[model samples]
Target: MKRIFDISMSLIALVVFCLPLLVVAVLVKLTSKGPALYWSDRIGKNNEIFRMPKFRTMRIDTPAVATHLLGDPDQFLTPIGHFLRKSSLDEIPQLWSILKGDMSIVGPRPALFNQDDLVKLRTEVGVHALTPGLTGWAQINGRDELPIPVKVDFDAYYLQNRSFLLDLKIILMTVYNVVRSKGVSH
Candidate 1:
């Protein structure tokens, strides 16, 4: 049921956001020297690695590390990168990942491939068994502000309490948070 819902919603969202996606792509290309999409290596379900596409918000030369880990991350932003990150527009391309089965609409956000501490903690707590998501409990709770262990705890909570209704609630809250531009730091 969850897989079916993910596919259906992802397809509808892709269709509905088609124009915005194109516009973002054009803007990204015009404002940056690299490809409009950045294919990041992310840790997915069961600790497997998968490529996740996001609208490129940083320059081509930016170090391949978590934005939070970057010293003065703003220095790497392309002209429109701040706007893209703040508006969460950079995430639109992940709909394709959801459609492709690498991500769900709601689950623990995927960690960067090099985030060994995060991966180990989540694995220890058995949170890695679930598919990664575009948005999740930790996302709505504190997003970039949450510490890694706390984020893993939230993921574990979701694993224990996951239900259709909980997923729906998470989705709705994600939209609200995105609209309000809450919890994002980069």
Candidate 2:
């Protein structure tokens, strides 16, 4: 059921936002030297690796590292990068990842391939047993503001209690969060 939901939503969204994606792609090309979409390796269910796509929101030359580890990070954004990230517009391209079954609309956030600490913790907690999602219990809760342990706890909660109704609730909260531009952390 979730796969069907992800596929239908992703397909419709891709068609509906095709033009906007094109425009963002062009803008990214004009403003940056790297590809419009950033493909970062992330861990998936059963410990699989997949390339997750997000709109490029940082400088190509920025360290190939997580933003949480950086200092003075605003220097890494392109002209529109901040807007995209702040508004969560930069995650639009992940609809493709959903269509590809590399992600779901509701689950734990995928861990970066290099984020060994988080990945190992997720493994110990059985968080990696589920496919990663674009938005989930952790995202609607506090996003990057939450500590890794807290996020892992939420992931485990979603894994144990996921359902259509729960996913629907998360989606609605996601809409509210996006509109208010809340829950995201720099």
Best by TM-score: 1
Tens digits of lDDT, candidate 2, 38-57: 99898998889999999999
Error of 2 at 64 (Å): 1.6
Weakest lDDT window of 10 consecutive positions for candidate 1 = 25-34
Best by lDDT: 1
| Per-candidate TM-score against the hidden true structure | 0.99, 0.96
Q: How accurate locally, in lDDT, is each candidate?
A: 0.95, 0.89
Which run of 10 residues does model 2 get worst, by summed lDDT?
A: 64-73
> For model 2, what is the C-alpha lDDT against the true structure?
0.89
Return the number of clashes found in candidate 2: 0
